[model samples]
Target: MAVIPATWDMYDLIQGVLQAPWYHMVFEVALVLLIVKIYISQSFSPEKTVLTDKEKETLVEEWVPEPLAPDVPDDHPILKSMEKYCIEGQNGKYVTVNGKSCINLASFNFLSMVGKKEIEDEALKALKVYGVGSCGPRGFYGTMDVHLHLEDDLAKFMNCEEAILYSYGFATIASAIPAYSKRGDIIYADENVGFAVQKGLTASRSHIRWFRHNDMEHLESLLIEQEKLDKKNPKKAKVTRRFIVVEGLYLNSGDICPLPKLVELKWKYKVRIFLEEAMSFGVLGQTGRGVTEHFEISPDHIDLIAASLETAIASTGGFCCGKKFIIDHQRLSGLGYCFSASQPPMLASAALQALKMLESKPRILVDLRENCERFHQKLMNMPGVKVIGDPISPIKHLMLAEPAGDPGLDVRTLEMVVDNAMNDGVALTVSRYLEPEEHLPKDPSIRLSVNCELTHEEIDRSADIISQSFQAVLGKLTTRSLDVSSPLNSVQQDNRSLKASR
Candidate 1:
């Protein structure tokens, strides 16, 4: 509008040229040519381009490349060494990779309820009633009637005043750790706490110290150190509250917490204790009430009792149950409780049913514990194996030799062991210690979790598979010198196995 500059004259010149006779003629011709082209290629027209069923089949046949299956390498040391544990499942027995099925020794179905018709029927009914998802976060619209019912049932079953649920066991730890402690709090935890709990603690920016796993003396020393610090910094500190956390049972070594001694320490030091009973809930104690009851202690002694519904409950979710005040405080304080999505209705329903069954029929707990003991006895009797933890708990672990402080097994080798058992129709989790030092008998060690569902025969067979797997992977190394290096060298021979182990 303000008299365009000479440099802008190019715009007008182009506009004038485009508006000339030739431009219009070309545009008209181009439009006609496009129409003709589209008419000639009617198969590719917008209205007709999609393929018919016959054409799609023909194209698929013509264009799809054959899938090349992965080949197992010949002369592979791992294959040669792991041959025994390379098993498959068949006829209800866990089979070797060569297809010899034996009794299953590896399954997490603790109550042996997963494949039951009644359980399936209940699950189906719940699914039909609640659909597949909760469709929203618990803080918004996710909490259904089922969620509340399960929470209430769990609290009652655990003999606690309150309980809060999370999507999974680890999620509970991740959400709860940071929620309770802060920058200035001192968190004294057992070395065996799960990774998720550590993550939570790390996020909370608290001063963290690790006591030896289940070592009451070490815990006392840590408590003394924290007390000394507290007295030293009485006037100028960030915030206060000493949190002592440990697992009710150690998953790696299949061991239980020293509840009496730990509780005593807590009483003397006046420090709070958080026990993650991922494996112990619904299985330990006289009434299936867990370590709190097993030790004849009340919920007041336990500042927090965190557990995964994935284990004994035969469902998916996690919860922390304790005193109403602590539970309520944690509800607001835990990010998982306040922010994360709650468990779905079907899972809640199933968990509630499982909890009710565990509570009313205490026989289930007895059966599970008996099954665990049976398995422990069977495995410990086997050649080249050492069993850890209380024989009565369903957490029998076969400790193996590491050879010169070298941890002999890793995730992949363990996975191979799992695969071998799975191929044989048994499903079990292989727990490899995070550190070689931890695998010491006095320290943490590699472990396998046993539950009640397995029969005596199944336990015997599983022990066989485990021993075979260890022997297959570890060769002739003695379980005693697993504290040495032979097993490490054996594992190192197979590069792929080594990589997988990590």
Candidate 2:
């Protein structure tokens, strides 16, 4: 051992020790071990905070929130008393409800193809081949051959250049409208347009000017006003696209749109026409081509036509047919088509089969028309009940001669009448608003969906039952009014007298 002088200091001593063979290796190993120990301690450190039982309970009580109640009252008498009728079998001309068979005047199976064996067979075959669902949106590898075939068939049937499919019937028009119309655009829509169109209009963020239902004059007046406004602001008007949206057949009123007049106005106002034919397709026209064929106008005259397969096609989806350019735009822009899972192959195949059947057997349409006419004629003869809609339309509305002074009472009376009809083995429905916020028909009515499968006997029986039910309900209401000594008793008495006269 060398004795270190005071002046030689710690530096010289450290140099001497580092020069030893074991010193450097031992120091390096110890340093590495110390670093490893520090890393292990920090990396595995616990993050959770430990608390006593009392602390935990206080924390939980502080974090918990009070239960919230709904803003709207949930205990309305009508709502509480209403029974939801569930069908156990196919909703065709007749359905099984709660294990009892009832004639289905409520379903929209206008062509009676919903439970057809042939359509079911096609659907079954497709299901076996393609499984239950498409599992992805149309743009994301979800386009099946069946969907394409159905689109092509629809295009050919409508005599349009192209067609596009949507997964849901309601989404067809809802997505199509927003795809073309955006904020700052103007939409001149019928006040009686279905709820689907109203939703689309809302989503489009467009300026909506509602014209009276089937009132071309009001529409024209609105168009004239728009024209004047456009003339005043030529640049803004040039940029703003205007559209005239109408239903081929109005669902609310059960009336047909004047297509020729709408087309004339479209050209006159230089506005694009969007026809929602959900209720008319496969029910109208010589070949079931829809309102355009029914009116003997060119399909090309309308910019876009949207219809649902759920109605006469007896399927689950919907379609839009137009020029290739117009329909192609929806591929990217239509939210429902772009984002929703594609329509199942089975449903698409079913729709295709239904369309084929419609084409091969044109007699179905004729039968439907005849049934509608017969039913309309019978309903016309009924007292205190006014029939609404074209004679050829499958949809019919039977309204009261006079409202019961109170909307709630009117609804209650109509509901009672519907219940009476149901009890008599007829499955009739009241026309309730799909969107209550929108303007609806003045008087609530019972909506009867006539199908080709409905026999003349069935039609007559339904009308008779409906008339008797109407009288019974009115008579009961009149009796109640008499008991109350209300002014409405006089009106109810008059209605009873009219019923007796009939």
Candidate 3:
């Protein structure tokens, strides 16, 4: 081998390579073109391959899903078609539905503030200033001055140490629950709790034990059983946190939970209590402070109070208020509050204005309670109808005495009565349970939501229409039952006559 200098010139190596073979350059050019061609071909080709039938079948078997059914069955009672109404104005005691003015009993506008000029004006002003959305979560530059103000006002109104706002009403309790209670924690929930609470309980992934709705004794029994279990599993129980969740006023059953009893149980069992006051926040108590105020119980007793602004506040968010330590935890831990976009400034302003109206006009609460009582008293005597709920509750459930032998038919019949009431110039609604898999009332019922704006005559008229519709439906049902039994009765009578003759 010839010896080369340790540091050979780069030019000398290039000259040697250039002189070695012209085919090398030709080969390099061809290779480069080939690479470019392959790249271009792949880029232009479709992402997926056209497979043979057998290959396709194998792939489908591995990855494809079976055909999906409809989200709701066609024969589902709630799917049955009925007259749909579109409100053109404020959702108050009376609303213009589908171009016809109807007495409204279908809305949750308990304080009749949805379309109030003052609230709307405030919302409009905020809209002009803030445009629309906060554009990010509260933790990420999404906390507006209005949001902080509303939270402060809510805390003051509820007489709590602190309050935190959620961008949505459903997300409020759902986020709050899981924020504190995690896996291995135990939650004692009511069977009749609303879907929101159920979702929260599910998200928490906690050990959930359900008790009968509004049955304090049943709740106490569950607590006792849980205590015993904890005692048996002392090691695990020492680390496990226990919670009792209840609604201030249940949406499905339209009944008030015995909060005083729940507070008693809370102390007795040494468990935390979480109250979801979506419906009762502005409908209960003389000052509309909800179940705690109604029962004259200190707000400090409840571990956490979560409520929706969508209802009586006529807004689009929710809040959780309690001791500073409890609410402050959700700032970092609540998934919805930490990740979701903040509520629009307009909606928050509307809620704040609604709260002011509530404070200024306490008469609205009285009016709402009176309307609820009057409706309850009037409907209590109706044939084949049983009114279920507290007399002061704005929500009432009128149940059928005898179901039409099927859930769908029974719901349809009650819905028909609601339709009839609508036809008679009144807007009414049927209570639809959100969770069918969970324990529900045996029979579905019509839900009438009373608002403060409803007048005496309006209430009376609504009661009369509901009464007449129920009576008519009941008469037809009775007639059909009699006709069904007529043949059996006739056969029995013929047999009796023959026996006598013999």
Candidate 4:
């Protein structure tokens, strides 16, 4: 309120103009006006009109509709089969399906421990203690002490330096492959390897050379080709790793890989060997040590072995066995291991129980081997059915002695036979394949799985039922219908002259 310096007032009341010392005040006024102009323009500018919650939802729904999966028709063969043969409760040597207890030739309970009281009790104990799911991956407090114990049990069981568990059987080899093999690496795989193996190879983005199924000669030729390629580019060969991928027991064909030859090639070519033992782990060998034990080869020769516990072990999940360096790498580098939750503690506990049970009862392996051989011999005597697999293989494919000219007809015939067998209280499966995806499509057949619990009576009954079913179905059709071009081929007489008999 100090009234002074009125002389500093630079205003022209009469002329409405004049400023020099008060230039700062004028500049400030201009700055305030500019800010007001900017605020006015922005405050009223047209952006999109804001939508209400319901309007926003409607717009989103219209713009991005939820997708529906392709419908599988009710009349689909697979669905029809499922509807006809719905197994209730646990699968075992004898499974209850559609209210009938039938001899099971369709289950994977090779060692017959699926519903054992001891294993169930052990699983329940773990379930109560650790709950159901592992809930997260190994590093995230998902892994339990039971999982570690099971890993150790598996490692020791396989006679390997270490082992790692996968929450899923399919993902075991899938994760193991890409963990080591990458783009630019070369993988030599069998033409009949399972779809999971194909997926792993595909994901690795490696250069894959496929050999004929279980053919050592073709594999050696591929190796020789690789050797020649190496000679051509020693520098690239030095940096590039070569891997030989094979199945211990080919799931598609039921034949074991020629391991000794593969091992020889592995050393001769300096390539790593990765064997997927999903089908053979608990079914092969005098002591069930798998293909390695069956052939008297050391597990050390193979770089890694991936197998599922679902087979002979009769449990959930899978595992990889090898020296510590290889398996430990999977812990961090394998996407399946790093991304999927740790296997349920209950499953790990049951697997551990099964492993221990198998160890204690070495005779279980002996029984399985004998049962497989017995079943194979029975199937061999079967007519109109060509048994395609190793004599000792627990999994065997009984293909048509002569293929029906039409693939669809052949499948329908096999499916009919399967239905007939099931009706007679013999549970059988017609082997299925995603033919479009298989490297070499497997021939249609009735797949038979032999379990240790099967007695001589059960085996004989199953074999008899299968043979009868085949005879019932195939005997109705003419050799001509089956497209048989045997010595009885007719000529110039047209279609009518093809004789049935006099």
Candidate 5:
């Protein structure tokens, strides 16, 4: 009864306040004004403009059509200098380029399994059964038993709960990132990560923080900063997922990441780690288990691992390995997996066979490591060049010791050296990148990929050819400066000139 009286008292108080004449009159006037506003809006909208046929034609004719992409000039540097060399057949320790058989230091056949009989037999069998293409995405009648078997094999080999396969190697990490990460999340990545990783980070739409290449102290500082930010907004931080993205072996730099330190930081900061092992998966570790195994760190500490099969497996497509729950989510959420056709069963079979071979013959990894070290040492002896990468890394970049200071000039010089090397029956490639798009653009250099089948004599010969090529090209490099309008004719010139047209 007392509660009822209090409620009545409140009601009476409100009534007394509303009893004033102005309050009622003001309420009525405001309601009337709102009604008038709505009426005015409904009664008065701008009329749509219409044009006659003649007028429309005139307008269309007056407007110039624009090109979808900018045009390249006849003298575009890359086009003018680029030479197309056709490869005759299979990739092995030696491959034929333009009908010339050369030491295959240019291909990514790290495990020397490209021409194996067992892998070819497996591929032939799959081709007989599944044909060339899957013809549909995984969800739409494209998944084959071979695909499932490969996934299972990969999961077991990587010691992960499950795995997901992507039709394209480039899209594996690119799609996996946006599948889990979104606008509000944050990704801390190495500045020197490959272009594929750069693409993934861009697609994720997450805030990215870049640390110096392979600098743990810089990474730790960024973590500390993020921790302090989380403290300020604990509620928001609870929902925001932080990830540290890095490559086990950098495709751009060819140096191995310090996995032990990254794992320690992952624990200290409570951030998940996503490791890309495209270049290291079958080229590192004692049995080619990759960087984690090389550093004796357990894969359980890492959240996800993505790698392309093209490198060591000598096949197409790629795969991501992680917990079952996470891998399963990509089936529905990953754009590449959901919309793109599944990988050809033949490639999967080839990759499976290759993986089996790697598991059985761990000696290949030993041979590959020895070859890499030998190549690295010999490359260092080459004049006018500096090797960038670890001794055990399958990939190495040979940069100019004294660059001409311009990337365009340096690229041309390196290309000249590559051409010379190719003529000498040693295939080589200049490291190429979309310079404008790189997070931290690397200088132009000759990128060399090591093959386990390369003999010590071949390694020495390749190194000698590279040195001779550099000495020849640099000797011819020249520059000239003259004052054509001078009252008294004068000229200045140097033997080294990258500014002059070739």
Candidate 6:
């Protein structure tokens, strides 16, 4: 009811509290009932019971994992057999692991060039001249003489007009790629390109498409699709450019890029191509000039060749090389180039020396190839092993196909292989590529790298240890069944088995 100023006294006289007490009581009882109903409704009711007690018990039993204490005992046959490859301190021939001496096949030091006397002396001199680190980002104030020298040396070695450096190998992909394209661009990536490269492309706010692992046909198809899209929209037609990105060698399968096919594709579409030569640069080609050189294709054939000097050159940092306009454009336009810090003077100088060394004596690359071939043949000859990749590259993969249900087999098997190799006085980093992905099995495989400095005897010793590890794993697999077919045999048969012309 409305109260007027004239009826104020009458309103105050009315029993409003008494009039609302019954309604207030009803509302309170309704709220209490509603809360109770909600609490009961959300609980595990009879209607929600999908299983009987007996079935529930069985499901619980199935979900429970097997006891690890019994299978992984200290005196376990698997553990006792794998301790022969351990080493104490890695020198020219061996490395130290868990207070023991062992031959090392696990390092990425392809040329075994990191600890050389002359290179070390040069690194020391640069340290004295330019101090330990760059004071700021390259774009702001850190570019130095050694930095320029390294870029020049890399340009000459890769046979490009110019080259630019990045402090980290992975950052180069992440930073440079997104800057090249925009919302209207179409990116076609390799199936097995490095995760960093894929991640960079995926992170881009632009549209991207993927091709099958080294499938040139799929790449061409995707390019055709992009053309259709471009033709439909005048806006996209003006800005949409196709870019094909891939690695020189896939880290997972140790498969080398089919450079000739890729080059042909580049010419067909007149699109840009970015090739990551991280694992192939210092290990392939006649003069270790990388895939382009291995195929006898000129640098002009490739729009861009990106690589990490740390892998084969025995130095730290990464570089991208290409034509003058391309290099200059990236230097000014690429966020990674404009924002990242320059390579340290010492690291830059070390890279320069490594490039010169590689050029002056081509024997290092040849020796590296020979070492790779030796290891691959020896491993393949052994019972129950598959060697992945071309015979020319130092990277090789040894996979285990059996013992299916062990969830930790991927890590455990790698640890077993690495641990056993170390005990036999052999050092090798177990391949981690396949194990980490959900798409891959728990017991993936092992990866081996034959350093340029490895001698025949060292290779034989490595073979023996690898054989021992395989024997141990095979014995462990006695409890289960395995399907073993080498991936290398498939790769070899599928594409014309063209021998890498060295």
> What lDDT does each candidate get?
0.70, 0.89, 0.87, 0.87, 0.88, 0.74
lDDT (Cα, 0-100) at 86 in candidate 6: 39
Cand. 5 Cα-lDDT: 0.88
By lDDT, is 1 or 2 better? Answer: 2
Q: For model 3, how does the per-residue alpha-carbon lDDT over 20-101 read when each residue is reduced to its tens digit?
A: 7889888989999999988888455667767899998888789956579647676654555422655686777688777888
Clash pairs detected, candidate 3: none
Tens digit of per-residue lDDT, candidate 5, span 78-141: 6754546778898798989999999988889998898899999999999999999899999999
C-alpha TM-scores of all predictions: 0.70, 0.82, 0.82, 0.83, 0.88, 0.74
lDDT value, residue 210 of candidate 1: 81
Clashes of 4: 0
RMSD of each candidate relative to the true structure: 15.8, 14.3, 13.1, 12.3, 5.3, 14.4
lDDT of 4 by residue, 77-170 (tens): 7788767777788888888889988999987789999889989999999999999897899889888999899999889988999999999999
lDDT string for model 2 (1-502, tens) is 9786786788787888778789777988999999999988855667899899999899998995656965555765436445456668688788876567788999899999977899999999999999999999999989999999999989998999999999999999999999999999999999888889989999999999999888889999999999999989999988999999999998887899999999999888899999999999998898888899999999999999999999999899899999999999999899999999999999999999999999999999899999999999999998888889899999988888887655655777888998888788888887777435665545677888998988888888888999999999898876777674665665566667876899
Candidate number that wins on lDDT, 5 or 6: 5
| Residue pairs clashing, model 4 | none
By the lDDT metric, which is better: model 1 or model 6?
A: 6
Candidate 2, superposed: residue stretches over 4 Å from native: 1-84, 434-436, 439-442, 485-502
Q: How many residue pairs clash in each candidate?
A: 25, 0, 0, 0, 3, 29
- The TM-score measured for candidate 6 stands at 0.74
Q: How far is candidate 5 from the true structure (C-alpha RMSD, Å)?
A: 5.3
Global Cα lDDT for candidate 2 = 0.89
lDDT of prediction 1: 0.70
Q: So what's the TM-score on candidate 5?
A: 0.88
Error of 1 at 151 (Å): 1.1
lDDT of 3: 0.87
